[model samples]
Target: MNMFLINFSMLWSFSFFFIFIYIITIFSIIIYIIPSLKNTINYTKFKKNSNFDYLTGFDLYFLLLTPLILFLILNFSWSSYTISAWFGNIIFSSFQYKIFFFIFFFYSLILTAYCSSFYFHSKEIYDYTITIFNFFFWILFLFSSNTLFTVTFFIEILSTLIFLMLATSTFSTTYFYNNLNLNLHNYFNPTTPFFFIQMLMYFFWISLISSLNLFFFLILFYLKFLTFDWFIFEFIFYFLTSTFTLKDIFFSLFIWFNLLFSIFLKCGLVPFYFWKPIFFKGIPLHALFFYICFFYFFIFLFFIYFLLIYMNEIFFFFLIINLSLLIIGIFILLFIICEAFYLKAFLAISSIINTLFVFLALNSTNFTDFIFF
Candidate 1:
């Protein structure tokens, strides 16, 4: 009789737990959809209120609530959970969660600061929705385990969303300028569809190349170690480095080069930076801000995480490559400072310099030194 009662209680508790999750899921979906529906229904009203435009009630609510949600998730021990499988896992340490929460809170502030700049047009509404969703996915990307495939998947999604957001913003700006009959050709050149096409093509090719390199690296890594988990990869790497055969050295170098090249391409480091200036030239200032502050920040964080995982095995190679890159970055920074007349060019150069400094920081032997630098 006692055993039966215990089993019944366990089942009841499980049912309650699932019910709570279901309720939260439904509530979240309702919260997300209602705002969008409200925006749509009030679109015509918003159009007439253009002169007094500001963030909508929903936007303000989202801005205020997101940080609270993140705080609860980060601080509450009960909110800590991990989903692991043979494929990959999504997890973050308490420290990482705290860092992410603070970063996201600051990002929310930045978004709020720029909220007034976004016009209340139909396309703008779509763009705003995309931006919010993209940020949510970015949070997902940050917490994702260092599984190469999973990381690549997130990268592809993010890149696509960025492209969409930029394109939509450009279109919306062009429409706005046309309606106002502005003579600001220098700000957003609507006449240069060809330039936009070229930029799009270049971005596509570069993204494809980066993805392919990462996929090839993933294949090589899986074949060598027969595992996708980064923790397991670290153990295998340590074991191989202990023996350190010629074949192993060559293989490791190839894998390292592939990974570094892909990350550098994504981060727009010195060698792979040609497309960035052109890309930035076409994007609006707000989009550029988002790209620089949020996108690049997370990519750099990912790179740092990657380095922390494999720093022991690849310290010599990393030191040599990073030093060389740093020297090149300094020269590029100087050249840009001398010749960059445009704001976009200056921003591009600044981003490159920031990336180089991050690489330099990674060379430090101590954690405090790394963080301080």
Candidate 2:
């Protein structure tokens, strides 16, 4: 009787989380679809006089498809949340939630691949048509959760590999076309700093995220292959990123204040000097186009990242604070780069250095215990 009661209580809590996520998805879908609700995206003004031709067929296809893609994905996402949240029910526990996560992972993976392919080769209609197929895939996958149409894991893996191969092929073709073979005449010159700095930015950005994903999957694999510790670390990290409150804010400020200082005020200062002139000279259209490919890549990765954050079951305050400070530092760097003013560059760098030191001190000591989920 006591065990039964405990199980029931957990089911109730799970149901609450499910409803909350469902509400979020519904709201997000509505906001994404309703143009009046969206904040105006000023891409036209930002790119005016740029060499790119005005709105191509590819652009029209992209605009028309994005909302539908987002909607179907979110819709299936909510359904999966429902089953996982309610899976404490005895009859559903064995395969429902396991299949749920697998399907969700693949769904996101397919969307990501399609988006990447589009980013690279916008001229292909057959590639774009795959986006429409995702809508039916969502429905079939969702219905399979409760009823018929369940696919074998081997088949699922095969399908995923196909999508990945397509994405790789398209991405390589695009990259090959776009990269110019320009030899550096003066590797030791001041101009070289620009190339090195950009490389550093890309490295750090990729490294931080790749590490996070690697750690996450490690936990998953270990649990499945070894003993089940219930992946407590995964839960802790997820909770920290997704849940927010005044308490989280306070904890973040107290823990990461110094690192924040150094990154924004110190580390980025010299870089700002390099970037200001670069920005005014303007990003090359071809370079911008290459970056657009990268931009889509990052967005796809971020979607996976935050999706993990939302689903993970643990709580950690320090991680969230550090991430927030990182965001602040990025904004400061962007501001300095946009300003193109040397004085502002100096001030921004100085301030960020001080901030970084403070964050360093806070991180060195143990103050995150006060953090609450």
Candidate 3:
């Protein structure tokens, strides 16, 4: 049985990592080598753009499909082997994992059908689809996370930063194609700075979480503490032991406040809401789509996690805060939505609604089961 238990998450993760390398190699052959191959072989009888166009975005659908299939594979219960060491009931093999993949699979299928839309775009725009697909590969691994929750959390933050960087690259690529420069002298926009700011937020979160993890881990280490035979996860299952001491409580509060503060910034809820409107302004619709789709994906998971963990709490502290966010965020957004004003403003409001809704869900649910509903 021990021999049978290879690290499947690591296996799938490294497999996708290699798949990306393989993909990049194939792209290299198509983009660079194929032209040389055609030129030497006197196959110029074909159209000049045919070789590049044929394969520019051909694999994007499969890239998406691969994860969907991996999800199915993990869930199939081969030899009745189950995923062990998951922090929760839901791991790669769980029914919830299947449901998650099914939803994303449908989304991927929809996006694949829309690849024809890319065909209508300029070669540059069409070619940049690779970045988007590559982005999904790392994100797929978030589901592949194993015993520790930190891996997924860190991967998520890294992926978020990469997505933003890719978005910026796409924007720069677009500008180059259309001969538009967005320098300070010509035009100042939100594209670069928004990603930069978010990256900073993610780094802050990572550093804080790592510090908290290390702090607790060292205490667990130095105290010569053996298993408490008990554990309670307040957030992300990081504490890893029974902790109810005053000092422990204070430390937990410190971690929680920092983590939640960073999240509030990302969600763009009230009082910390200054940056999101400016960030949304003048951004391309495609860029906006990337942000909405990916950011909310993480936010939704966090929402669900919090709902499960906090539902049975004796205190109503977080409940009040979440309710405050929902009310204040929604009422402010109502003014933005009703005004029928700038497109970016509407987009910001629409995007922020996901976060507000999460708050609303958190506020309304008094039980873990309600989270699923």
For model 2 the TM-score comes to 0.27
Winner by TM-score: 1
Measured on C-alpha atoms, candidate 3 has an lDDT of: 0.48
lDDT of each: 0.61, 0.37, 0.48
Estimate, for each residue in 264-367, the C-alpha lDDT of model 1 and write its tens digit: 78768756776776666555566677777777777677667666765653544445566576667666566556425556656776677676666556666643
Q: Name the lDDT of candidate 2.
A: 0.37
Question: Cα lDDT of model 1 overall?
Answer: 0.61
Candidate number that wins on TM-score, 1 or 3: 1
The list of candidate 3 runs beyond 4 A from truth reads 1-77, 84-91, 119-128, 146-153, 156-231, 234-247, 267-271, 309-320, 323-340, 365-373
* List of clashing residue pairs for candidate 3: none
TM-scores for all predictions? 0.73, 0.27, 0.60
Output the TM-score of candidate 3: 0.60
Candidate 2 on 132-194: residue-level lDDT in tens? 333323333332332111212212332343333333333233433422232222222322234
